[model samples]
Target chain A: MSQDSQPRKNSRFHLTVFALIAMLTAVLSVGTPAPAQAEDGTFKLGLVTFLSGGAAGPFGVPARNAAELVIEAINKGTLPAPYNSIGIAGQAIEPIIIDEAGGGTKQVGEYRNLIQRKNVDAVIGYISSGDCMAIAPVVEELETLTVFFDCGTPRIFEDNKYKYLFRTGPTSTMDNVAAARYVLDINPDLKSVSGINQNYSFGKDSWADFKGSIQTLKPSVEFKTEQFPKIYAGQYGAEVSSLMLEKAEVIHSSFWGGDMEGLVLQGAARGLFDDFTGVFTCGETGMFRLADQIAEGTILGARGPFGVYAPKSPLNDWLRKNFMARYGTPPTYPAYKMAQALMGLKAAADKAAATAGKKPTQDEIIAAFTGLEFEGPGGTVKMALGNGHQAVQDMYYGQYSNKNGKPTMTNVKRYPADCVNPPDGVTSTEWIKNGLKQASCK
Target chain B: MLKTDNTSRNLCIAFVLLLLVGLILPNWLAFLTTIALAKAMVVVGLVMLMRAGLVSFGQGLYYCLGGYTVGIAGQHLGITDAVGILFVSAFIAGCLAALLGLLLCRYREIFFAMLTLAFSMILYGVLVKTSELGSTDGFNVAKVTLLGWQPSPGQLSLVVYSLACLVAFLTAFFMHRYYQSGMGFAGEAVRENEIRVEYLGVSPQRVVFIKYVLAAMLAAVGGSITAMIAGHVDPEMAYWTTSGEFVFVALLGGTGHVVAAFIGAFLFEVIRTIAFDLAPYTWQMILGTTLLLVIFFLPKGLWSLLKAKKVGGNNV
Candidate 1:
């Protein structure tokens, strides 16, 4: 308040302004990209997944583990026959792994950083449908080869086409469609059905596809109560109680990770699983982790022929052996999906490079990847949908049964990719509503 | 008059320097800078309330509203003009704030904070359930033309980055003037003692309401720009955590000067980016620890560290 302090306050105010400018300059200077890392005979790939948050343990970490295992194998030429070549296109593999815990907006920024800053040759990541949708357009804009390992929303392709984007896993539509078909084949006496899925795109799409397929498959089936609790709502006491009250003959959920574990635990405790035929479209994620808690007769799928239901193949054998040896847990569906994506990329790159007799250009890689078919640990994966940009693989379903002390799946069935997935150029919604007339089943 | 001129000249010089910086930034840094500036705009509005001793925990209501407005406009109504969308976003947010401000302005302190948060959460809940808008995943935002001049995909980042800097400059320039104006002084008086403000024939309630609505409009502008740059909008934007971030930046920068909001936001983003790269699993812990250190060492904020000396040892 005194004149002497007045001048000092004025000087301090200016000093504060100067300090702010200096700090900003310092930060921006750090962001100024260093000369892009020289291409040191290695393919720098960005692998993104939920490294933290609720999805980390069950989904993201497994996917990350698979990437590390698969990339190392690819780099060392240790994978099976078709993928025995070292690294991608003869270049040693280098991965820049990033966590995809933040929401879509943050993912968008991170995706740009991966491509523009890290200079990744290709990006394989995104388990959240929201993040996938957000990054898809940016992928095209950046014109970098990026593969979405697992995000079940069909809208990504059905909404817009991307030249640089490829999803190496079947959409949630197949998981639901396969579930409906498997349940009907196992139990033709199905009557009323209900669902309790997370209130998000993946959950909503799964339930819709399942319901539509069920209606088309058996018009006599009655619809019952449906509960969509918020995503990651760890406590499902109220939702379980509602499902119990409905007393629907069949219960379906596409919940994954902690949400799936919580729902199964709470529902089993309340005897809902005992009374209802519980079907988890993405249950393969919990097959081993929640083995003791899951009751018998619960039909579950690995989204495709993955994990316990993976078709007998050399690739599957290699992945299972190596993943189990490294992580102490069997590779789940997320792990399978990650392996499939990396293999698909490597296969395409190898093909392109072989034809060119050198490192392939991005366009050459795209040409080889589009509509290409390759064998994965799960089964033969065909880029048969989304104009050959999206993978359509055979789906497997089985009953959860505990034998002795270990949990396992029984009565496993495989639905051919074409039989379960919509044919190219057809949306899953339209394909299901029209009774899957174009479907070719043997 | 001389002091005001000096401040205006300094703002202009700073603005030009930022514009120059935007031009040279790489694509990734441009995107990050765009996001930080967009968030800084929202913090500017929060600082306005902070000056009046009112903390709004739900500024995200307007922020999300602005984002959805622009998204809906582009995806639904076919409006893609960047400038036009910004105005429409601000107007829509202002209208909503005007209606809500009537009831919200009456409350003070924690009640005011919680009420704002409740409104934002309500928007988040509604957006999550609206299947037409893509539900919880929300939907993508299309690229826009700048005054009918469309930039190529490669050039869009720089264009939007420059625009963000420009907008921030204008917001800071006007807000600095407002801070020195009668109404601005009235806000401080209300914070210091409401009775004195009322004794001066200024209705404290009316002043608070005006500040509330203006703050909402500012937040909406921030949200709209973010949606444009990120090309995506979701219910998460309205979630309490997003609002908490704006508050965190406000406290970090201090309400000492208009530029503090931006300085704080930039530092927060930089720290987060580095921490994430260094310790991907424990970045949140690093962020929390940084805030703790800031509050402990410089209670007034990072801005106070620049001050010549500590007087009276007042922490808040």
Candidate 2:
């Protein structure tokens, strides 16, 4: 090798090494945030949701949009009464949004980063049940005030007690229980029922609860055929064929997102919905997008009294109008749930400050938030279960109809909070097994 | 000869520096470093497989086995000692690998990759169906005791980080020495030409089988350390995407050196954390771009930048 060539090669090698080191240093510094101090005066709220994943389009993005819209409104003091305050406890809300595309392990790391590095005053976002269950214990360990916005798993609070964690949205129990009651309400002499739900926790738990509740309500009713296709399995050709063949009176499902849409298209094309009464416990999100496609007379729900079934109030009107103007789409149930979580957080902070006559600490907020009754765009939400850490609200189900080329809900039925949700001391499974004896419907 | 000595001395220095760094790292950085190092263990073993011309896409099988072993042992046998749990994790994963390696060694290339993936998916299916273990949600692991010394919640992360540093050092040291052995060279030869290796009186299948089992144990140990740090184990650990991530890390560092895995894994984690923070909506795109740049420019991986070329030949 020539002397000049050798020198050039050596310089190149050194330059490359320097570049790698510089890149690594830059990356490391990105992780090291400014030291935690409350003197900044701005409340840093970490918002986590599915920003980029299969769940993003229908569930996560709407929740994120709702959070942005609500936080913006609160910062401007333009919200309806009781929520027309400039941020939580007189501080401007500065959000640090994070994508919840990764699984539990990655989420735990991000959750720590939010608390230890960003020093977020509180966190409020999660749509996946797995992510919720995983982050609950971490929230307590770190002692950071967190509000789970949209995950519907009941196991989060029932399985363990948390000091710093609260789920503003009602659990999945209310969805299925209300669906069962609505099934009985619509047809008092319901004969046979079957279901097709995803095979994971949300789907399995929903199916079990629905089946158990229906059986308890009417012992003579028969279960014909149940199909549990894997979660996110878009095609349901075989399952649809089986359900059609069974000739059951009612076909219940807990499908959501793309899978739900897929089933509506496939099942509708196959005339499965026409042959049976379809009850979808989590179907309200698809009402607008699949308006023309959804079969007429199909029973739909919004997880709780959300979306189309939400009570008309000033808060609801503001959310609908502002959200439509901002995003060109009406907010769905997930959006309503996210708005509810932020409202709940603001209420707790205000209450805690009122009691202390100053800025409330984390413990003060926790104390004030427990068993708090707050008004959301979806009407009243009460933290009445899981020792006041879990929210319980009324659930609504309605029949879908295609009237004059527009989708509309007909025969809307509502189940009060106490009538569907299990009592505080009883697990949903145990409550269902006991024939829902404590249910008090007016 | 001089290059080998220099590499060995550099490994020692790096290991010591890593431990010292762990002692002073802030909690969040320490958590990131610990997870990166633990995953590096799996990548290091994967480097050995790459050297032997075999790529197992289902390394998650052992990774999941390791995590599940720690969880199951703690729940059923009441074993909270970190040392005992790690051993059980390694032992169970090694035994399963040994049994699977017999049939896996008979295949090559895509067949080998697919069969490994099949086994991993089967495990994922089983774990997902098992509701007692929390199914897709997974159960949290109890805080482990260190030889009967329980750490307070405040000190637990530090202790776990320290433990990870020591284990990582031992793993790298052992693999460094192994690479200098004849069997290690035989692995490379098997990759080059299995027929030629046979003529040299070494059975290619045996070398591959032994390496597969060792690799499985290493990956399991990595998985066990991660479970302890995260304090939770779910079926996602065994998902095919996770195994793909292992492969991605292996390539990011290359198979040139054992320490390359550590450097590569650290860079991967740092890049991901920063990218996710910077672009919440399109972080995956950033990661994809980084991988593309690495493949185009430093085809041998980021490790190649540190390796000085000899006057007459390439640096090993």
Candidate 3:
């Protein structure tokens, strides 16, 4: 009995030892500190974007590429005009890239990890409206300076107030409102209008705002039909069939990423575009991939003055040339949005440093960001709404025409920021419902 | 009786050990562990259904229900008490399960799985359409209070970690006993031969209904704690892919023991984090290859390694 018990005791002891070793290794491995900051006190920025998943093609990849190129340009002082600097306030920029392919809940955890574990000074990224909304409150709670680059939801600032959060891009209302104004500008006799958008906040809000604007702009336009398909739904056979049945004069859609590509391809195969003129609010992002398939006169809008509608300038030319050279394709709307965000950050940081006479804290940066205006690749981006926390910018929409082998926006009409964005102290919904009566269109 | 006593003693010791680890682990590790334990609770619940030869492809429905309940309670009703939110959410999920289980217990195999998937998708659709609930963005969950104490952001994370460790251990203990009980054996018996179980005067449908409700309640508890710790909830919680992950963890751990679920969840999270850090673009490929290798070598699961050693006379 003693001999049998001795073997059992030895095995139990071995098991305990093994468990202890495993726990110790796990703790030690995770406890490893982040890499040391570079010489000259680098400004550590956590850049979050979708590195994988459906959104990667149009939004995430371009945003991440722009971040990489812009940071390199700032560090090398190769950028032109207002952005020509050694770094943000003379500090080298170091970026830690994190994938945003995970859902909003996972993104919250990743946001915390980026701040607590990675020790980033600032965070700049988020393409999904869901991710932007989720991280907004957390960044406010943590008091971490963050810049949302391309999420267009108007609800982020409208729903809740955040001091440390700033969005350097136009809200969804700007895109839809501009699209409506363009339709009215070109087609004065527009009779019937229809829409198809992803069945989510970004899509739903875009459609509502567009409808509201069109009603305010041209009350005679009668509604035809509308469809709200689920986001990332690869097939649009049923939706296309329904739209064809309506036979409306104008069909507006706000699809993006792989969903947009799939919609354009599937719709083209069925000749949906041939039956009616289609206005794609986010079509510019997918033009590179769908240039051959897209119909000649299909209307297209970049969420803002992006891609082909971007204003010509030395700074814009330099950015376009460098981006095309490195990426082997011209920068899309998402890239321009990211560049605008980074440039806004640099300008804010420079102002803060100048005011404080040293490297500024998150609070100082927030102060400088409020009511800030700076030159973007497109035009000037102004923090005109949400108490100067949200950005308002010029927008453009036009018909898609094949230029040589590439698709480009033609007959482009630019709308100033004041013409599309809601005035201060007015929610987008309220503003739209009120017929945008106060909006000043040049 | 002596064996039961030993099992309880071991559970207590394990609980104490986990509590100590929760206290000492760094914030990030603690956060990761809390998430793993919360996810493990759902996987263990999935294992309960798996033992009855029922594979739910839509456990995410209950998970999201629980998460959204907590979020809504905290955001709207101002119910910030951790325990209060957890209990309320679990009760809501239980009531929903009781109603759904009556209809679900009649089906089996792929039909049952598809029904579960359909229900979850319905919830997703509703959530996406409800603009007041932030639509697809969902909403943020306010910070929670423990009893009457309000912890700082840092302390709240640690407190939540400790609570998760305690809750997970208690859940595992009860589930272990449930697995050994007569009803638990009846689940397997029915799975093996429903006709034999019926002849033995046991109602297989009744057993499955009870098991379904129990699994739903457990999953809800898991979802509530996860929402609290993450401080957010969204429609993705109800998405089919999220349900698929719970099933993957269940299969990876095996239905051998309740403890296997926790182990599997921890290892899965650790492997995923490492893979994400090492290869951001192809992390899914790495996870897929690992799962394939594990399934090839250990058909029963990673848990079988311990059982195999015990059968070979190295019992510990």
Q: DockQ winner among the candidates?
A: 2
lDDT of 2: 0.88
Q: Is candidate 1 or candidate 2 better by TM-score?
A: 2
- Rank the candidate models, highest DockQ first: 2, 1, 3
A268 Cα displacement, candidate 3 (Å): 3.7
Q: Write the per-residue lDDT of candidate 2 for residues B202-274, one digit (tens) a residue.
A: 9999999999999999999999888888888899999999999989888888888898899889888888888
Clashing pairs in 1: none
lDDT score for residue B144 of model 1: 82
Q: Write model 3 residue lDDT over B40-117, tens digit each, in one string.
A: 998988888899999999899999998998899989998999988888888998999999999999999999899989
| CAPRI classification of candidate 3 | acceptable
Candidate 3 wrong stretches, greater than 4 Å: A1-27, A34-40, A269-271, A403-408, B1-4, B148-150, B309-316
**Is candidate 1 or 3 superior in DockQ?**
1
lDDT of 1 by residue, A203-296 (tens): 8888999999999999999988889999888999888888888889889999888788888889888888978989988787887777888889
lDDT of 3 by residue, A269-358 (tens): 999997788999998877777889998889988898888888998868977999999999989988999999999999999899989998
- Give the C-alpha miss distance for residue B251 in model 2, angstroms: 0.7
Query: Which CAPRI category fits model 1?
Result: acceptable
Q: Between prediction 1 and prediction 3, which has the larger lDDT?
A: 1
Report the error of model 3 at residue B12, Å. Answer: 2.1
